[model samples]
Target: MKEGPDIAQLGALIGDPARANMLTALMAGGALTASKLAAEAGVTVQTASSHLKKLESADLLIQRKQGRHRYFALADDDVGALLETMMGLAARRGLTRTRTGPKDPALRKARVCYNHLAGELGVALYDGLLASAMLDEVDGEPVLTEAGRERMMQFGIDLAALETQRRPLCRSCLDWSARRTHLAGSLGQTLLSRFESLGWARREAASRVVHFTERGETELLATFCRQDQNSHGNRSQRIMRDT
Candidate 1:
């Protein structure tokens, strides 16, 4: 007979409702205390702690101790990616039967994934970069091109300075809502920070939704239009019309 599935056990660990809710909350890359997670999962602190122990044992989460309190987050990007994939599959399978539309306009526009942008704006930005030959997918990571380096500089991203940071510069993160890849990594973090600094985007209170300012919308349209003109001459018009 065929071998029993290696990942079957792992799948079972994530299949629990409490564990799944905890994972979903942690997907935003925040270190949450057990009490906070308990509230998010609609369970008691003791119950949430029990589930968290199981998840931590499975290497799906990591716990850190600060003073006397313990904080939990996903083990790493790998865990986050797996969770995002599961969410996508669940959505496709009609698990979200009651919620069939965008619940928040800000989420439909742009939002944070841990430290990077996600949603339609993020997806479109990624596509624009690819079309301009600034980035490419290699394995599961995003590899920046020489042209990409120049383009990023033009956008006021200090790529040379970012290289010194001890983190992956470019990674392709699967977007839970868009079902496509958006930029993640140190570069992605920097871009998000820059946007926030410029007042282009702001995080919602107690939510993962990210709101774009009026200036942000204007800037985004202008930047996208310029990239489109450069990439397709007049063909960009046709592409947008088709979409």
Candidate 2:
């Protein structure tokens, strides 16, 4: 018979606070160097390295070498999806709370998710797409509808070519801030790239926060009406007050 999964091993790896923080940082969808991760985890380099070794051994992370430096990222989207689910459960169980701080306004607007858009704008767009019958949720995955394909084609996405790729076309990634699912997968990445290509959004230097351009703001307002109306009004006001 096949061996059962090693529950204890998985549990032990994530049980450490430092390792948890490191994993969280990776979940933001970028490979980071040990030094950067160390700072993020609020630990010394030595301690972070030790934790990273453990996580790597657990098959939860992967490391790549670039010249002399080593960068670490999650093993795959599977790892990120698992972390997202865990975070969701944690929130449902009241094990964590939303962090409040002085954050960039643009970040609150939109940002990258591994390779796709995330944050309030991303989540709202996902919702709008579902509501508009552009996508359908099936067995935890988002499937593009016929209308979605046509719409994407008009938006300059080659739907047939995207399907030929090995990567998923549509996926749902949990949003850290909104605690909701956003678009992910190749389709998500394509949408983000298209937005950037159109000068709709730009990434902040040394941060994951994404800033929308004036043109982007107008385009998004015209495309996603609900988000446009809600973004700068009662919703933001409430978030500001609550935070």
Candidate 3:
């Protein structure tokens, strides 16, 4: 017996075209109905249901029931993190699809990796937090600094409440587009949520892109300004280029 995890099995499960598409759709951090997921996968409802069963059986997805409707989401943040990393790997290897559109740039700028921000802006945010000493690495794992705690509270994020969640308070997720690390875990989710609530950004309908208004983008860049990363240019340049 191979006394190790079954990578081949997991790969086979996710390797299917329809299954991969369904999983990718769930990456937007929304629970999707089977029919909706079927549309995303370009497969029939029966096929989507069968695929969903396999995903759920493998624990890659978790089922949710609302009234008579059944919805499904990624099992947890770990699964999301894995998928994001795999995407980065795919991009790095030039294994990406040839299809291109305007949405590609938007997705590469600011999109949701599960429930938190990702892409160039996401990399920028992570860089900012580290540059400002708001987040630090203790031993090997990332940890929030005292300043980060105070800052989150001031920004209306309840750190104490976040700590009570099942997942860690802070963790770094690899951004697929940027090939760099970005925030994840409860704190990451809260930050994204706060951005939406404060009108700093809005998730596009049926898409993962999170578009920030002109003013909102300004404030966001100002809030997480990275003084040391001068070579990366400034907020104005990034927004102009992305838009």
Candidate 4:
């Protein structure tokens, strides 16, 4: 007998096709009713209820009561992160869905992963910060430097408020479409919300795709890419001095 935690149990709960679909729908970072989830999984409401019960039992989901309705969402950011990582691995192995259409490109370019950004734009944001010395990967985790905090403040992010949260302020979430890392954690959530607040981007209805207007995309590039160029120039000068 394996003298440790039973991963098989959790695996089985998430392995079912119906359950997997339902969980995927919840990855939108919002609560969904059993009936809506049922539609997503192509199952009946009764069946979805059963699957929801199993997921809730495993602590993979949370059931919330609002008025007379019961809604379900991923238990926490951890569950969402795990699902994103699974998708990334599946993409790496070529285990992707065959249905491709116009929206596919948009999804690959900019999409939301739970509470944070993912896809091409998301990876760019991560890379931009790293190059600018606003973020660092230390001891296998992403950390925000002092200058990073100041930069975030300039971007209208409240660092002090973020520090008060129980959740991590910075985390790296693997992106499935881009096959790279993006920001996660509370700070990541704040950035996404801020973008929406500023009308820079908006999440599509019934979809994970994020649409950025021309102005929004311009602003995003102007804000992050300027720093990227400086970082590149600095590195080139250092190499010239050495060689």
| Clash statistics: count for each candidate | 0, 0, 0, 0
Model 4, which residues run further than 4 Å from truth? 228-243
- Cα-based TM-score, every candidate: 0.83, 0.80, 0.93, 0.92
Q: What is the descending lDDT order?
A: 3, 4, 2, 1
174: Cα error in model 1, Å: 2.7
Candidate 2 segments whose C-alpha is farther than 4 A from its true place? 1-3, 97-99, 104-108, 224-243
CA displacement after TM-score superposition, residue 221 of candidate 3 (Å): 1.2
Alpha-carbon lDDT of model 3: 0.87
By TM-score, who's the top model here? 3
How many pairs of residues collide in model 3? 0
Estimate candidate 2's alpha-carbon lDDT, on a 0 to 1 scale: 0.77
Worst 10-residue stretch by lDDT in candidate 2?
224-233
Selected candidate, larger TM-score, 1 vs 3: 3
231: Cα error in model 1, Å: 9.6
lDDT head-to-head 1 vs 4, winner: 4
lDDT values for all models: 0.76, 0.77, 0.87, 0.84
Candidate 4 local lDDT, 18-127, one digit each (tens): 99999998887889999999999999999999999999998999999999999999998899999999998999999988888898888888888888877777777777
Per-residue lDDT of candidate 3, residues 120-168 (tens digit): 7787887777778888977755799998888879888988888888899
Per-residue lDDT tens digits of candidate 1, residues 34-146? 99999989999999999999999988899999999999988876787677677767767777746435645556567778768887677766767777777877875679999
Stretches > 4 Å off in candidate 1: 1-5, 97-102, 138-141, 154-167, 229-243
